[model samples]
Target chain A: MSFFNALLEHTFLQHALFGGLLASLACGVIGSFVVVRRIGYMAGGIAHAILGGMGIAYFLGQQPMSGALISALIAAVIISRVSRVSKHGHHQEDTIISALWAVGMSIGIIFIAKTPGYNVDLMSYLFGNVLMISANDLLLIGLLDGGVLLFTLIYFKQLLALCYDPEFAGLRGIRIEWLNTLLLCMVAITVVILIQIVGLILVIAMLTLPAATARLHATTMLGMMILATALGMMITSGGLLISYNYDLPTGATTALSSGILYLVAALIPQRRHAVK
Target chain B: MPALITLKDVSFSYDDRPILDHVNLTINEHDFLGIVGPNGGGKSTLLKLILGLLTPSTGEISVFGKHPNQVRTRLGYVPQFATFDSAFPITVLDTVLQGRLGKTRSLLGYNKHDHAIAQRAMAETDVESLQKRAMTALSGGQRQRVLIARALACEPEILLLDEPTANIDPHHGESIYELLHRLHERITMILISHDVGFVSRSVTRVACLNRTLVCHATSPVDSDSINHLYSNPVSVIHHDTRLSLEDNL
Candidate 1:
């Protein structure tokens, strides 16, 4: 109880909590679509692809998230369009995504190496530091989360149609191409907001795992979204508490917690006989 | 009567290989058209073109005197069961509700009327009991019924189905056809099936495709005519065993 009280009193911890909640909500909602669409690899590719923008921002002496956001948005568009046109199969799509991921990571590494007196705390960027979250970051996260939630709610029918049956959706007057592009952009924005808490390495897991777990239990799309958000919050808050007490990397711990939750859900006895 | 849908000298190809060539067709309102063909004969592609899911390489196609996409609100489609991954986490009700997506005003969300329509569609298809069930849990026939309900929820003037009865038991398949038979009174239907006898019985007309349009005519078609239309020599016994056009009709 004392530790809980102490943790709550810290201003940075407060920001971290708020940030985590907002980010997790975004991840949980959009992540459902990502998992259903089988775009897990694309989400990872977009996350790593943002590294190029981070490198560019560092070179330009600007905030990294802005660069990350722009680069990620561009990469998301390019990757989605490429994946759509390639037509070979899932294997080819995975190869292209992997190539883009490698190139983006290399760009960030090279730029970071060239900078002088660049002895920054890289661990904070990689593993997340709850103690370093700022008010501005929290505000940005809140607004972006609101935007994503609004867009998702407004376009829920269209998105559901696209996710379930793209060809039929097109037949029903849904603009599948535009909807696909919009979804990719939404994912890019999600990755940008998430980078401050989970970082690039773990953001994909944060986005996908909670949704996948929730799907095992949910009967409706809306139910899946709510359950996934709840699961994400649990992982984020519980992981933060564990990291604080044990002095471990916050992002890795949070992601691992979500992974464990997924495994547990998978193990739960399902009503197999009910299935027709 | 003026045709509700017309295709004028349509041709299509994928990567320089001709799939549909110089074809023309017409469908009247309330007509039930069955498209039959061998594998890779572009039967599905023809349906796609009609639905505006694919663009014709040459010629023009129109639905109700407008482009297919422009009149999409009046169109409902049920694709092949194999085209969908039933493992998706969605309820029967929600899946059915998606048929009304185009009618809803953007950003306003679904209204009471939409739910009512979806419910009515489910009731009509006899899948109302499965409304709350996870789509993955349903049998193939049940899933197909839910899909049909989803398409019907659109209140379309035309309903398109691709091999809707492929994987279901014969009883369920016949029941599905019975349901569609009732539905044909108010809406135009285009169905694709390889089961020649079944389609010949259920449909008002039959269009045979073999890399191109072979023949299309009103049913009670002669079995001998259809047998000769197939390019590869198939034993008459095979056709007779699988399909009995006279008995089915």
Candidate 2:
């Protein structure tokens, strides 16, 4: 009954709640594109690959978040290049990503091993600590949310054209390769930010589950994003509350909320698609 | 005046496999050119070249007397009907509205004028009523019409379609060609098709492509020319006649 009181009472809890909302907005907007583009596997690969960056950061006594972000970006580019830029093995994106995914994770483990005074808590990175969100982290999340919102706003139509009909978009003078690289970079940022909510292991689920559920009900990309955001907010905040009250993992609870909602959405046969 | 699109001694190859070998062609303003060839005879490849999707391995190609890249916005293209994924959640109107991306370059995307153009294009393609329909919910014929509506949304001077009639029922095929026939009076069109008999009646001129290309006024595309163009010494099945050009490969 005093849950609202506790939220007001605890600053960390307040930060966690606010952090949940920011994650929801970014994930909801970014997740729709990831699911629709069929790049969920790539997102997963990048998420795991971020471990390499975090390890390198620890070894160098640098900001682990920056390392993770840069590594994720590099992994995104390599995957895009292998799948697109390479002349012969264009279709072997999954193969290249799979190789990188393992290589990245192993490199991180080795780096962490080699570091003399490596006392960084791997558990927090492996399975996110939403409750441990700092003021700086919250600020960074807010900035990322702004950037993502601005990008979607400016490129909504072009992105729609690119996603729905790439060839036609290319014919219309849209630089397909450059735009693709930019989109992947945006996705990399999304992965970096979302790690706090769902950790590396569950980040893909965090990214896709709400968007997939929203896709069941919404017909337009805009509608999909809005509904997915609302769903993500409900799931993330709800999961945070449940986890706090019942002493469970915040990431699992948040992701489980989305998975449960998706099941329910799937069960309800989608309404007939009315023309817009 | 320069032709709307001109390919001067253009040749394209994949590895050692030749697609279009030393082909020269010209398309004038408001010309309806239907390109017909065997399955692997570079019919679609020619459209790709014109659309600037592919570069010639040898020689030069120009659209509107400039490089294809410079004239892309003025050219509307419909790739093969086989390439569309109907499972997408986009609406017919939204799909058609994509054609206006070239023009609607503002913070507030697709103003009233853009919407009006899309509506007119949909009307032109006879998909006005179905604009609100989900793209996946539409029939094959309806989807082709929507695609044409999208291409028309560009208000293009030259329209190129890879294969609009493939995988469509004959009744729908005829209707699609009829619609194209109506549109080509204002827009120069190049349609690629392997079925010579079905598409020959619609185009004013026909281009026969193997590794080499041959142009014939629509009335005189006899089996002698067909035998000469195709590798097999065989006959062609037209709108009436049933014959097979035996495969040499």
Candidate 3:
């Protein structure tokens, strides 16, 4: 009840609640693809790699989100290119992602340390503070959400085929390598949007949890996406209310909410749909 | 009859190791060719080369008088069952609908024509009844039929199946072969398999690959030659008398 009253009284609280909804849009859509393709680790690596971009932007007195967007796109391209060129396969790709993951963190730490003045927002950036999201951040999140949704609508079939059986897609005249790279680019953008809501640390959790939970019940890909979005909304709003009432960190609370739901869904014994 | 596909002196190597060496073969229109070989004998490599998924290091190949890549849409492919993700959240209808991907151009989604074609393909493959079922819920035999339906939805001139029955029991495997036989009248087929007996019994022609290829009619294939080709004892069963061949390895 107090949380509802605070939502009515505070503009920042409204923005946080609105921001969670917008972030959930991209998370439900792109996150479904990430989970189905089993690329959550790659998304996590992309998420962590954004710190380098944010730190550089802060050091240069520029908006950190812009730097994040640039670095995420660059990291996605580099990772996909390495994956395409490596003859040895996914092991090499995994190694490259780990390297970028650590390197990005170290680079960010050095840049932030060198920046002048007390950088109090560092923890907020690392862990995220949805309450601190400004009007401009809300607008940015909306635009990115639109971009993610549009891309998905336009390339739905191609993306579906790519995820299901890439070799077959290639035979059918889909340029799978380019399509795969474009998908990674989408993942990169999605990571940046999620970063604004959950920060780098919990971005993958937000990206994967709702979609994974939805997978248990969805019968189709589109069904999965829609159900995941609804699930995301529930999880995000539930987390926001809990955090507001208890005075806890909003992002971590939201991620925690999603994780608990996913575990609960998994524990329920589903009738074996698969044949032996 | 003119050849539907022609390969002249094709050789493919991976990282300086040869997989296929100087293989020349011709596939006529309506030919049901079964490819048999030991594991790592380049049988699958030959199929990949023909499908334009891999390039031959030194050879010239042509499909319908053009390059394989140029005519990819006209060739339907059913990959190995082991290669698929059955747990994916897709229905049988949607899986078959992917076969019409080449013809589906609208951004709105698959058109009415696409759905009709997919439906017909499903009916032909006997998976129309299971169109709404989740892919994960289907048995291995059912999944294989769905994959074949997906390929058939392409309305392809030639169908390529890579070990479609590799994971199924002999009962299901025979049923899959029967399904393929029924479709043979309208579409050319190239099948890869380890069951020498079935290949000899089913296909119009058999190609034995052991880093190279030996083309033979079904009637003259003997166990001694096949066992020597595999460098071990191999069982050769005869299921019919229509196709008969025997030779020295």
The DockQ leader among the candidates is 3
lDDT of 3: 0.89
- Model 2, B12-37: lDDT tens digits are 99877888899999998778998888
The Cα RMSD of model 1 versus the native structure comes to 2.8
Clash pairs (backbone) in predicted model 2: A275-B132
DockQ of 3: 0.66
Across residues B130-231, which tens digit of lDDT does each residue of candidate 1 receive? 898888888889999999999999898899998999988888998899999999988899998887767877899988887667555676555565666575
- Report the lDDT tens digits of candidate 1 across residue range A124-181: 6555665578998888888889989989988888899899888777766778888898
Cα lDDT of candidate 2 equals 0.85
Query: Which regions of candidate 2 deviate over 4 angstroms?
Result: A1-5, A87-91, A116-118, A272-276, B227-249
Candidate 3: lDDT of B154? 90
Q: Tens digit of lDDT per residue, candidate 3, span B126-242? A: 999999998888889999999999999999999999998888988999999899999999899999998877776668998888998988865356777697779888676665555
* Decreasing DockQ order of the candidates: 3, 1, 2
Ranking by lDDT: 3, 2, 1
Which parts of model 1 are misplaced by more than 4 Å? Answer: A87-92, A272-274, B235-249
Give lDDT: candidate 1, residue B50: 85
B3 Cα displacement, candidate 2 (Å): 2.2
TM-score of chain B of each: 0.92, 0.92, 0.93
